[model samples]
Target: MREKLQLIMKHLRQGSLQKMWKQTIWIYQYGRRYWKSMILYTLLGVMGSCVSLASSLISKDLVDIITGHQTGRLLSTFAAMIGFAIANLLVSQASGYASTFISLKVDSEIKNDIFAKMLVTDWESLTEYHTGDLVTRWSSDASNISSGILNWVPNLIIYTFRFISALAVVLYYDPTFALFALLGIPFSALMSRPLLRRMRNNNQKSAAMNAKMYGFNQEAFSNIQTIKAFDLIHFYTDRLKTLQKDYISMRLEFQRMSILTSVLMSIVGFIVSYSCYGWGIYRVWSNAISYGTMTMFLSLSGTLTSSVNSLTSLIPSAISLTISAGRLMDIVEMPQEDYSQDHAVKLFEKQHKTSGIGLTMKDLSYTYHSGTEVFAHASMEAYPHEIIALVGPSGEGKTTMLRLILSLLRAQSGEFQICAGSDHNQKLNMSPSTRKLFSYVPQGNTMFSGTIAENMRNVKPDATDEEIIEALKLSCAWDFVEKLPNGIQSVVKERGGGFSEGQAQRLSISRALLRKSPILLLDEATSALDVATERKVLKNIMQDTYPRTCIVTTHRPTVLNICTRVYAIRDKRCEVLNEVEIEKMVKEF
Candidate 1:
């Protein structure tokens, strides 16, 4: 079982190697933008390593010179060593500055790219990931990548060079001393295997706990009002505590393993140094090696042992960094939907004579993931210049049909088409740009913390003041908007905190209207409004606006009364009411 565990740990460590190379290449690509700075930094690092090696060699020479009473040579060597030390310090500082600058630049670039990708991803796919998870990946995971660039890259290079150079110098003085120092390599390798396994397991648990904690916080903040209304704060708080406990336990276990590894590696270092010292002294006493040579060999052996130990200590962190890089690469390498085809065309055409595109569904069907069918072989059509009302008992697929028409969800089997013009010659599948042909106001009047004008600009970025005012008038919102202290420029809190539900609904309508899309879809748009406000808004939308295709999904009598045609959805089928029947139904409602 232990061997199997060791094998699993080895595989896990190796798994991240490919990702590390990829991340290294990405950092190199980023460094290309500041090649001059990168070159200077690399040169300085090399110089620093050389200075360190020179210092060690100089120490040995000074000891030998003192033993022989050569004061002049000893003083000259001490002065040269001091000057090299200063140069090393200056170069190391400059390299740090350069590394930090490069890291910041690369972090910004990666973050921006990730955010842009999130924006353009398919809505369904994007919704599968929690908002906080994405945020953590973009921020924390990218930070790991940046650290690999700034610290790991340069340090790995310098340490590897120093280790090899130190080993070479020791071996030149006495090959036996160098071999003794090298014995630590296998001991380090043995200790690292189990420690790395423990670390990997702990890291996985810690990451899972973090994701859970972040998810809990995100949901809690987004629905604080509901949590308070329902008095569920303690429930969420307890859950958060559980996650925190798990994270802490995992971190403690990881630290314990690290400490154990460090202690074992230190023991190995001491053994190697003692063995080398004992053998060197015996050789000196036997006159097999001079005292001065023995001293130089001892100094070089100590430096080599330290370098080997440092390299061994870095292995665990390097493994962790590689694992983080693999996670980041998973996101960066996700296969995006192909949107680069010549055949791909916008869903709407300006030359279409129809005021709005007409939708037709022929034998449409859909099912949720749990194998529950929402609709099966249902069909319906809505034309331009009319308002279609969809009414049904709750849980009978009213919203599902609307989503199918909007292309937010695809039909499992059947044909749905948007005939672009009155002649019905132009038909196209929905694309990203085509989604712009319709304006949608969902069940909630969601708003951001921004000025009213800024919210309007979300629908139409370049909308003129006159156009915005006209849209507000059409939505019966201009009166309240004008009453605001700053009119269109008035600041609104998140979700329109200062406005009543009815007022927020009207603001959402005004924003949608500003888009001037041919098709308008209102899914329970006025459900938050009083009877009087609902009547006024419905009247303006149906009577005052120019002929356009409008679909409203609601059970409200006010909406049913104003719609030009009413359709009842029952048993996954749509049935249009006769004119007299519709009028009678409207009158009764």
Candidate 2:
């Protein structure tokens, strides 16, 4: 039974070690560009350790010089010590700078890779993680991985060499002295294994709690106005206190385990120090070793103890790095959006260069992963120079249809295509790349924090003042924009904080218009505007010189007057209605 238990334990230990090694190798790959500096940094660290040991050895020579009555050589011997000191200083400074440079470089590379991956990952898959969790991984976990690659690995290597060199010096004078000094080595390492495991589990939980707290705070602050109006301040405050209490409890538990491991190591360290001292004194009294040599043994033994402690500390650090690496790899390994096979983007770009295209859907079907069927056997078509209105009661997939049209959500089964103008008359299936052919203005104020001109230039970076004005005029936004003190250059707050909902909507529409894509999608973009203003904006859009195929999701009846075709969506189906039918539906509302 004992042998069987030992065999099982051996396999478990090997499995854990193999897993940690793989994670370390993966993190190292991210620092490949800085590997050259990292190697030099480790070499410098080894040299610094060598200098420290040399100083301890030279102290023996100084003792010998004084006791043997060799006073004449004291000046030259002290000069040698000074030389080692200067060399150590230089090596330490160089290693410090190299480590900093490597850490910063690896941090930047990791962040850039994660950011690029997030941009190209499938939209629905990316939404599985909250914004706060993603940000925390990007900022905190990435830094930990960087430190693992550039700092922890190199320090481990340097400290191992230091321990070996110090042990050799002590053993040269008296082998038993080295054994006494290393009595606590195995104990320290063994004590840390369970502590390391516990620390890693606690760290993962703490990280999750922190992300939840961040998400809660972000949601609360973003809806502060709603909370104030509803008189829910105490409710939010109490919720915050609860979250903080949980966080504090988690942290305290981790610290308690760490302190227990520290106490065990400290006890072993005290025993080792006293045993080495007794062994060294006995060797000197028995005339087996000289006084100078005995002094060197004690000094080098202390050095070995310190090096062992440093080495053992790395076990916990390595565990932390493994957790961080695993968190970051979760995002990096997710399925990315396939851009190489996007034939629709190529076709749309070719067709839209000269003229616009109409959208068509045939026998479309879409069901959520939770088995909620959003659309089934749905079909619709709209031509350029035409305005199509998607009218439906709330929760009837009006916005879902607009999202499907924009390729933000893909259908489970269907033929959704875009057919070009008369010249080429090519047909292509919708994909991620096809999104480039459409300019979308989603619900609410989507304006970023920037100057009005800056926001307009986002879709068209080189749009001149004249071009910006033209797009704004097309959206009926120039009226208010021109009245501002700085006109288009006026600074806008985040989410259009200083602007009314109606004004922000017009700005968002103008930014989309500047793109001049073949297709335009307005998903409740005009819900905040009055009837007269909304009507004027739609009129301006339809009369613009460049032709466009417009699809709007709206519950407002006023927009129906200008729509060339109106479709009502209900019960997972879309039905086209004539003007009379639309009038009857409007009256029923």
Per-residue accuracy of model 2 over 1-589 as CA lDDT, tens digit each: 6975885588577796677677878877776767776788788888888898888777778777877823548888888888888888888887788778767877788788878987777766668899888888888888888777777867888999999998887777678787898898888767765767677778789779978998898889988989999999999999999999998898888778768777877788789878877887898789787677878887887778889888878877888898888887788777776666366576566756656788889889998766789899989988778899998889889888877887767899989988775533477777777787899999987999989999999999999999999888888889999999999999999889888999999999999989988889999999999989998989888887677888988889877978999988867888898888878866876
Count the clashes in each prediction. 0, 0
Question: In model 2, what is the error at residue 259, expressed in angstroms?
Answer: 1.8
Q: What is the Cα-based lDDT of residue 516 in candidate 1?
A: 70
Which candidate gets the maximum TM-score versus the true structure?
2
Off by over 4 Å in 1: 1-44, 58-79, 119-122, 145-156, 270-348, 353-356, 543-548, 580-589
The 0-to-1 C-alpha lDDT of every candidate, in the order given, reads 0.72, 0.83
Please, what are the lDDT tens digits per residue for candidate 1 over residues 1-589?
7987887677668865455577656556544555454555566777877887787767666766777634457668889879878877887787777777777876787678666776665555556677777777777776765665555555666667877887788777777777776778788667766767666566556655676678778888888999999999899889878878877887787788768777877788788878878888898788776666676676666766666666665765666666665555556565454454223334254556335576667787888655778887787776677678888778888887777776666668987776654755666654344555688888885877898899999989999888888888877789899988899998889878888888888899888878877778888888888777777777777674454567888876555656777878877777777777666766877
List the pairs of residues colliding in candidate 1.
Answer: none
**Candidate 2, residue 538: lDDT:** 90
